[model samples]
Target: MSRSLVIAPQWIGDAVMTQPLLRRLHARGERLTVGAVPWVAPVYRAMPQVEQVLEFPFQHGGLQWGARRRLGRELHGRFDTAYVLPNSLKSALLPFLASIPRRVGYLGEARVGLLTHRLKNPQDKPPMVAFYSALSGEREGLEQDRPVLRLDAREIDAALAAQGLRRGGYLVFAPGAEYGSSKRWPVEHYAALAASLQQPVLLLGSGKDTPVCEAIAAAAPNCRNLAGHTSLAQAFALIAAARAVVSNDSGLMHVAAAFGVPQVALFGSSSPLHTPPLNDAARVVWLKDDPGYQPPLDCAPCFARECPLGHHRCLRDVRPERVAGLVQGAVSSA
Candidate 1:
């Protein structure tokens, strides 16, 4: 049996998108091992197709040479092929140092020699789902191939109980984006949406989102801010059991899609064409492209950390009423 090692992406959305590639590898009868950060490791662990998950302890953008060398030694000769996913030069160091004979990856950051079979990044930059899936050489079922995860029912129940929540009792809202505030919808809009839905809203995100979540909870009755309170595993369970999820273009949005949960995904600054949710159950509303949206075409998809122009109309113009309408439709159908 052949064994493969995959260097997982750092972002949750990217990690989730990689599932299709993993599935493709599994279909080829390869046993898979994934290297991922602590926060994103749960995703790989939840995949039944994955045989092992190795934790990458280095901080983001930090290159710890000694630690990487030691880890490389430990992983030496364990895999027949290693698919390096991240574009940074450091991302290839472990697999290269481990002496994995066949390393495949995109030619990134002058990493020409590190990978034996280097794939060129397409000029068009297709949707991330398609982009990652193509790396495995099976690109035909792009739309039909959704990220699938097996959640423990008991664990889901426990997560709900811990949050004083019950299955189908609330709407899940993820309002934070690690990318930047430009990608986040206004708190007022989220509050308005919560009030309109009449269902309790459970705000989900990392601890960084707590203040904003708390503000929204305060503005809307029956809303609870659980940001930073739950582990990634618990967050997955909560999202799996949600009545419906209304989320920004963030990692949890992809998590909701993985469960095939009905969701209203809000997008701004970033184009849905690049990193859209893969499941049919998701309704993506890209504000800049929506009807009645009149922002300068150039201003959109800046993909900037913060709007350089300082006017975040891409997100602000997408009214709560529009989002609420979508959520209501999704919930009713669900």
Candidate 2:
């Protein structure tokens, strides 16, 4: 098998979307080892196609050239090819430094010469999953391929135990969106939904989400806030074991989709048409698609971190009752 190094994307959602691309490589007899920053490393562990995950020591922003060089030297002669996922110039630097015989990625951010085999950036943006899968140089089925992640049942059980959770006994409320408030459904809406549900609701996210999760937990006695308390591995196991999940268009939403857990994905300033949860079990709630939602959200999918219009009608218009109904149905059937 040809050994390959995958330079993973920095953002958690983007990292999860790359799974389909990795799968394509693994199917062709490529042994995959992923290079990821600390935060994204956990998701790669859940990918069965990946043989190893090398967590980079570099912090966010800047080149961190010396560190990259050291890691690249350590990886030298270990891989035959490198697939760089991000479009930024810095993302392609390690593979070039490592002297991997073949390096492939989309050309962008003036890193033209860094990659040995570069694909032109598509003029029109494509779904992130397809964008990454193209790095495999296989065009067929790119759009149809969905990301999948797996954890052994024992691992799932242990994670649940640590969180004081039982399999399929709780619902997950991932109310925080890393992109910004524009992508997050109203916190009050989440609390309202949890209050009406009989099942326990576990709020999960990064440290930044603690305040938001805590607020929701306070409003709903049925909700337990675990944000920033559990490792990403535990979070993954929790999503995998959830009876159903109610989440914004965030990384954990993608995680729930990958696990094939029943989910209600809320999209606001971001468009689901672009980064949708590519799972059969997911139901997307986007007001932009609802014609009856007057005056229609033409400004929707502004892709802004914050709503420019002051009123976030896109998500604000999507009532908690609607989301709660979907979750209730999902739980009943599951």
Candidate 3:
């Protein structure tokens, strides 16, 4: 049997987008193992096709030379091929050190010698999922088709009960973006949108987003904050059960897309074309020219730790009513 190991992306959204590649690999009849961070392990564990999951030690800080060497020794003789999804130079080092014969990944950072099969990134890849699917040797071209994520039925049921959600339909909103406040929509705006939802609003995010979710929930009594409560798998299950999801351009938005849930993804600083949600049912809302708004002087979208402009107009300018309208339309259509 052909044994293969695939290194998963660290971010939850990137991992969700890489599912098509995972499914493609599974169809090839290879014994598959996934290497992922502890936080994202729950998400991969839910994937039926994945046979094994190896955790990267937190002590390594992701690039500890000794840790990489030790992991390599343990992984030796385990797999014939390895596919790395992340572009970091360190990501390639683990499997390379493990001495996996065939290493596949995008031609990034001039690691041509390290990867045995390097595929050039596709041109004009609109949806992020299409770009990831191209990396799988089994898939020939960019598949513009909507991405799909399957969850265990039991888990979905448990998620619904945990959130008190029902089939009558509900909205899921994520107002946090881990990168920085620049990527996050205003909290008050999310509260306004939640109050307008036709059904109960389910708020989702990590521990960092607790404050935002709490404020939104307080403003809209019908809203429930599930931030810091659900595991990654539970988050996916919840998104799958929702009629629609309204979110800032973050990982949960990607999860909403993967589950084919209708979504309105608010974007600021980040370009929608580069990383739009991968669901056909989703639409991206970005700010256009407004006379009062001045262009961010310090190279906005620098993907920085903080917004250089004291005022985060990129996200602040997007009105709550507009987002609510989109949510209404998405849920109505569904």
Candidate 4:
């Protein structure tokens, strides 16, 4: 029996994208374990591939050293191989400390010595999910084109009942991104889209996004703010039940893809080429730079927390009608 461990990515979107790899590993019938942050543990709790879900105290930077040591001690001599999905120097430290013989990960940050099987990162990756799926199999060819996420039917039913979602149709709007304001679509644009939807809209986000959700809900009479009320699992459950999801490029967009829900994703400052949603039922809308309409002096897509130029035109220029049209088309086609 080949005993294996996978260190899951911290972001919800990345976690969802890693599901296909986990499923492939599970199908091999290996003794598999997953090391993940506490918040992300629930997402994989029900995955049959995971023999155990190990939690690491992560959120705070200070606890990482101690957590790595503790995890290394607890999992020492337990797994024959460990696969790390996140491409961070710090992520490599734990499995190495745990003394796992074969640590597999992409070649990045000059961690060649740290990883036993260091796969070269793919050139011009098709999608983020596709890129991650390549890490699992030996064939080196893309194992699968579609990303898969397994959601319990009971959980879906419960979320539907709790949210008072109609049986056949509803629209979901996720208006937050953890990366930064640069990745977020304008909330008013979301409100305009919600107003145009034929079905009632359910706003999804975390506590930090409540204010934005509230503003959209207030603007659209049929919209309801469900942010900050549901757990991460519940949020996915709700998304799974919706007819279509209109979102910014965020974790929920990835969750929507996992569920195979129709989605219209708005992008600004972030490149869809690097991390496009991995669902066939999804479409991405982005702004093409116009020389005459430059709103800020800073480089757009700088991938920064706050816009370097102070004014944010990359996101602001995208109209609400454009997003609404895309969402409407997606829902109608589905």
Candidate 5:
């Protein structure tokens, strides 16, 4: 039996995108284990392809060399090969210290010496699912293999009860993008969209989004702000049962895609070419450059958290009415 370990991505969206790689490995009859942070571990744990999930408690960008070394020691000789998913130098440290014979990953962060099977990242910058599955040497049929999450039905039902929510007939709005404000559509726009629709709205986001969600909920009486209150697992269950999702490019957007929920995704400060949703059910609305506009949209998708130029025309210009039209259509069709 082929035994392998994968060092998962730090971001929840990226973690969900890694499922295609897991499925490929599983198809080859490999026994896979995942190493991930607490925030992302549940994603992998829900995948049947993963044999085990190891929690890595280190904070982002913090070296925590000692912790990595200790964990590496504990993991020594347990796997024959390791797949380093993150490009950061630190992402490869554990496998290096663990003495895994075969380490595979893109040659990034100038950490050349750490990996034995160093692969070059393609210059084309394919969608995230394709980018991740490239390491598995199976590029064909990847686009068709959408990310899948298997959550306990009982847990999902319990979470809905706790949130005073029910399955089906409700619309979900994810207005926060952890990437930065640049990626987020204006909260006022979300509020306007909420007001336009008659269906109940569940506004979702992390603690960072509570204020924005509150503003949206306040503006639209039909919207309920659940940002910062629900755990990631609960959020998954909620998205799984949503009638349709309207969101910025974020983790939950990917989650909705995984569950085959029809979604209207807004892209700003990021390129859909880089992280487009794998599910065909999603409709991407990318309006980075609108010709003849007052502010030249030529410099959009700066990929910055905050708009460097102090104007987020990339998102701000894509008015609420446009998005509301799409949502109305989705709801009506559903």
Candidate 6:
């Protein structure tokens, strides 16, 4: 079998969306190894198609040309092909440095010369699963590909045990959006929904999410704020075992989708059309489609970090009762 090196995307959601692409490559008789940063390494670990994951030490920005060169030297001639998932110029640099015979990626950031095979970025923002699957050189049926992920039962059990919980016994609420407040459903709304849920609500996120999760937990007695308290592996394990999940269009939302957990994904400044959770059990809530809503959102999908109009009505207008109904209905049916 030919060896293929997959350069993973930095964001957790994007990493999960790449699973379909990985599946395509794996189905074609390629032994896949993913190169990822520590933050998203566990995501690839959950993908059964990935043979191994090599954690890169590179930080967020700047080329770090010296570091890429050294790693490239170490990896020279070890792979038959390379798949660069991110469009950034830096993302494709390492493969070029390694002299990987075949590098596949999109035409991005003037990286025309870095890749041996390249696809044009779609004129329209397509579903993320389809966007990544194009890297496999298949253009048809892109929308039908759904990402799937698996976690060890023991790990899920361990994560629940540590939290004094059990599989399917609690709901996971991811209330923070790394992108900014624009995508987040209001904390007050989250608290109201958590209070109404029959099962315990476990709030999960990074350190940056601590404040919002804390406020939600404080407002609802059944909610436990675990933000910043659990490792990413622990977070994934918890989400995998959750009875259901309620989150913004963030990484954990995609995690739940990949695990096939029933989830309600709320979108505000973002559009679900582009990155909707690729799971049959997932329900997306974006007011952009609601025609009856007064003072309709014309600025929706602004894709801005902060709401340009200073009123996140796109999200805030979505009442807690609406989401509570979705969760309760799914939970009871489950």
| Each prediction's TM-score versus the true structure | 0.96, 0.98, 0.87, 0.88, 0.94, 0.98
Q: Write the per-residue lDDT of candidate 6 for residues 121-235, one digit (tens) a residue.
A: 8888888899999899887788899889898999988998998898888899999999999999998999989877756989999999999999998999999999999999999
Mind giving the per-residue lDDT tens digits that candidate 2 earns over 72-155?
Answer: 899899999999998999999999999999999999999988999989988875798999898899989998989899999998
Better of 3 and 6 by lDDT: 6
- Model 3 per-residue lDDT tens digits across residues 1-334: 7899998888887887777777777888888899998887766776777899888874434468898899999999889999988877788888899999999998887677889999886565356777777777655655553446678789899878876677436778988998888888888888887777647888889999999899988888989888999887888888888888889888888878877788999988777776878766787787643354556334545555567757777778788887778776776676
- Stretches off by above 4 angstroms in model 5 are 289-296, 332-334
Over 4 Å off, model 4: 46-48, 109-113, 121-126, 137-140, 289-301
CA lDDT of each candidate? 0.88, 0.91, 0.79, 0.79, 0.87, 0.92
Give the alpha carbon lDDT tens digit for every residue of 1-334 in model 1: 8899999999998999889889999999989999999999999987889999989887887789998999999999899999888888999999999999989888889999899988888887578877777778665887666788778799899998887888988889999999899889999999999998888888999999999999999999878888999899999999999989998899999999888888999888888888887767778887667666564556778889898888888888788888878877777776
Candidate 3 vs. true structure, TM-score? 0.87
Identify the runs in model 2 with alpha carbons over 4 angstroms from their true place.
Answer: 332-334
User: Candidate 6 — which pairs collide?
Assistant: none
Give RMSD to native, each candidate. Answer: 1.4, 1.1, 3.2, 3.1, 1.9, 1.1
Query: Could you tell me the TM-score of candidate 4?
Result: 0.88
For model 6, the stretches where C-alpha displacement exceeds 4 angstroms are none
Mark the regions of model 3 whose C-alpha exceeds 4 Å error after superposition: 59-62, 107-113, 119-127, 137-139, 143-146, 289-302
lDDT tens per residue, model 5, 255-328: 88888788899998898878877666777787754555664667866788899989787888877788878766
Model 4, range 142-207, lDDT digits (tens) per residue? 535545677779988998888777555688889988888888877778877777765688899899
TM-score: which is higher, 2 or 3?
2
Error of 3 at 190 (Å): 0.5
lDDT of 2: 0.91
* Model 4 weakest 10-residue run by lDDT: 288-297
Pairs that collide, model 1? none
